[model samples]
Target: MKSNSHFSNSPFGKQKANKDKANSLKNLLPPLPLFILQPLLNHIVSSVAKKHPELFNRLGDSANKVFLIDPSDLPLFLILQPNPLNPTLKAYNQNEIIEHDTYICGTFATLMQMIDAQSDSDALFFNREIRVSGDSEAMVALRNALDDMEGSLAKDVAKSFGVLSKPVLLAMQKFSKNSGKENG
Candidate 1:
């Protein structure tokens, strides 16, 4: 079986090939430069801070912690430092090494749904759809903070960017709903 694993018809072979193709495609696409993307990220955190001050407050001591949000399907990674006085979200290349208190890995849709309280974080983690490491207590605090809040954080995130907010938010909702992780 191992010797014939390269056969395209084999399930293992097909999965491997698809994984390789994904990785190859990822390498071909460079993430947007941080300098170019940082302003938008800044606006997101700032707007969220202003509109939902309780979010950081809910984070308690974890508010000072740094988080690396890694979306498996995207070519970029997001570094979130939700410090109350100086909160920030920044983009980085997938390979960029950065210091962070915690790492949250999942698909973009899953992360968004989790933030919006549309999906069960435990189910997502148990099912291996989302992987979290480091600062367990802080991660819990962050989750609790998001859960404690009302309203759609995702919608607020869209609202941070002017003009296309509504459509973008609708698209996000549709995307997450169709993402098929709602049960989780």
Candidate 2:
């Protein structure tokens, strides 16, 4: 009788390994809870407004209306409402604001990029990455505001997620590599 190989006999073992690898990758992704993040984002915007009021005015004039859509939520969108009359710079989540002429976007990263580039709205739209419904002028204005705010926006976003700490980010990367090794 010929000796059988242990590895060849168990197909389930390979499947389990694959599943574990997928789980590990899932765990490696940064934990970003939008509910907690929403307020932090608001604070960052307020901080930018305070630190550079001119930038805020530029954005306000250029992007009179803006919408942030959650990719996880698909059709649902979050509209940023910065009270023009209020000094405190309050941000509201009003559904009605979505009806206005605005730049509709899916993710914060993409939105940051839009604000940074100030002229990629058409590109994003062509790629189906962003969907704008009305007012080209408003879109242009929104882009300009993003340009003005680009300097501090990225840092503020990173800080909001606690990734501003280099050590912590490095540690997480190391942990992810180790976990990948174990899974492999």
Candidate 3:
């Protein structure tokens, strides 16, 4: 007669193994954190602003208050104060007292990624990725400003971010080929 290993027939061991497999699967998912992304976005926005001071100037004039609300924090808006005097963008939550010039609301993840990727920010509005609930005229003004900025910066930023990459298509093709081999 031989002694059984500790985990060989233990219910707890089976549960632990299942848990470990689930954790491994979770680890395989994309790991982009919003906190890590914010600063990168702030940098990109600031850089774009610096490159084209005219746009911010126009935005400052057109927009009385600007809010950057994260969709995850629904019903609570994160107001972005664009200082005309100092010309800097500051963020504030609903609880935090601050002045806003205009509200540009979206999911922080989507907004930051769009900005960083230099894709059409207006796409968010049209595609309903970002929703604007107030001040249609102001939104239109902001859209025009973004259009101008996009004309100047989108190409360069898209190239730098590799937004035009066909990696997803390539990956799908590769996956289909592998699956065909398995079936054959």
Best by TM-score: 1
Compute the lDDT for candidate 1. 0.72
Show pairs that collide, candidate 3: 64-101, 65-100, 65-101, 65-102, 66-101, 66-102, 66-103, 67-102, 67-103
- lDDT (C-alpha, whole model) for all candidates: 0.72, 0.45, 0.46
| Residue 121 of model 2, lDDT score | 63
**Candidate 2: tens digits of C-alpha lDDT, residues 1-184:** 1111332243323233234334543335444445764675576667666655665566565333433332211222344544444323222222222233343543444554565563376787788765553345555665566566645454554454565556644554464445434433
* Per-residue lDDT of candidate 1, residues 61-107 (tens digit): 88887777876666677878888998888887765555566667777
Clashes of 1: 0
Off by over 4 Å in 1: 1-25, 171-184
TM-score of each: 0.76, 0.50, 0.43
- As a whole number from 0 to 100, the lDDT of residue 1 in candidate 3 is 11
User: What lDDT does model 2 reach?
Assistant: 0.45
Error of model 1, residue 146, in angstroms: 1.1
Q: What lDDT is obtained when candidate 3 is compared to the true structure?
A: 0.46
Q: List the residue pairs that clash in candidate 1.
A: none
